[model samples]
Target: MIEIRGLTKSFHKHKVLDQIDLTIRKGDIVAVIGSSGAGKSTLLRSINLLEVPDAGTIRLDQLQVDFARKTKADVLELRKSTAMVFQQFNLFRQKTALENVMEGLIVVRKVPKEEARKIAARHLAGVGLSDRMHHYPKQLSGGQQQRVGIARALAMQPKILLFDEPTSALDPELVGEVLDTIRKAAEAGNTMLLVSHEMSFVRKVATRVLFLDQGVIVEDGTPEEVFSRPKSERTKQFLANYYRDQEPEFTI
Candidate 1:
């Protein structure tokens, strides 16, 4: 379980997060939804200590993460249990798909070279990229490269995966493949915290949903409760505009 209490962050004099408290159970897929700059990305980074919090505590299982008291060593250890995937697929341009996935296992985790390669192969296959293992990031399509990114994260065997707008950079036709892969992972019991603009995908995959506005989570509940019956007017208004372009039309 992950528990966050009184979490707060600021940039210079501007606050990006304020007194945020949330709990994520093991094997749960929680989607964080909000407009741009609403602190969704910042919140995920704070949990992994990538973005230091000015105040508050983050607890993962029995491990306590106090950003205020954290050292370089402490942050490194915390990151091993939590891995992040960015919207842009950050793979090495010079490396093959398999090598890109194995980079972390060999460098940070210090696994043996041969063993890491085997593990990398398995994960690449898991993401449906077995044949593309020899391909470089530039050689593959956007969706394929993102799958490589996912494989790289999976090879780390993190307890929690944080996705910051995973499909935001993909073309419309490519989005479904990445989302499908994520859906399969969630079904197979991978704990995840996702920051996304895709409402329909969130509605289908998330067990719980968080609605944030102005650096605070205004609504938090099951997908059905939050999306279909939001308690706040801000949430309702946001959803109305968000789904406006996607709503179907009928002709008499």
Candidate 2:
């Protein structure tokens, strides 16, 4: 399990995240949804220490770190337990899909080259990229590149996977492929925290959904509850605007 307590972050005196506390149990696929600038990405980034919390305690299983006083080693140890798949599919331009997946294993995890190659190839194939494994990121479509990003994260086998708007950069036609790959990962029981605007996908996959607004989680519950009977006015208003342009799976 992962526990966060009093997580707070500020940028030039403006608070981006404020005194947030949450817990993610094993095998829980938690989806965070909110309007733009609602701190969803910040929340995910903070858990992985990409955006260090100004004040907080993050506990991953038996490991804990106090962000206010954590040393570099503490930071590294925390990072080892989490991996992030970004929206932009941040693969090295010059590296092939297999090399991108292997990079972390070979460099950070200190796995032998041959072993890393085998593991990377397996994960690339898991994301349906076996034939494209030898292709560079630029040569792959958006969906394919994002699948590689997912593969690289899965290869890490971290305690929890973090996805920050993983489908936002994909074209509408390409979105489903990446979403399908993520769904497969979820079914395989990888603990995940996803920030996404794909409400249909969120409703289908999330064990729990959180509605974050202005640096706070305003609503938290099952997809059926939050999407159907949201208690917070802010959540209702947000979802109203969100579903106006698209068909919501649940009545808003």
Alpha-carbon deviation at 73 in model 1, angstroms:
1.4
TM-scores, in order shown? 0.97, 0.97
Reference-based lDDT, each prediction = 0.92, 0.94
**Model 1 TM:** 0.97
Candidate 2, residues 1-252: lDDT per residue as tens digits? Answer: 999999999888888888999999999999999988889999999987888889989899989899999999888888888999999999999899999999999998999999999999999999999999899999999999999999999999999999999999999999999999999999999999999999999999999999998899899999999999999999999888877878666785
Candidate 1 — which residues are off by over 4 angstroms?
Answer: none
Best by lDDT: 2
Model 2 TM-score?
0.97
Model 2: clashing residue pairs? Answer: none
lDDT of 1 by residue, 1-252 (tens): 999999999999989999999999999999999989899999999988888999998888878878788888778888988888889988999999999999999999999999999999999999999999999999999999999998898889898999989999999999999998889788989899999998999999999999999899999999999988999999999988977868777657
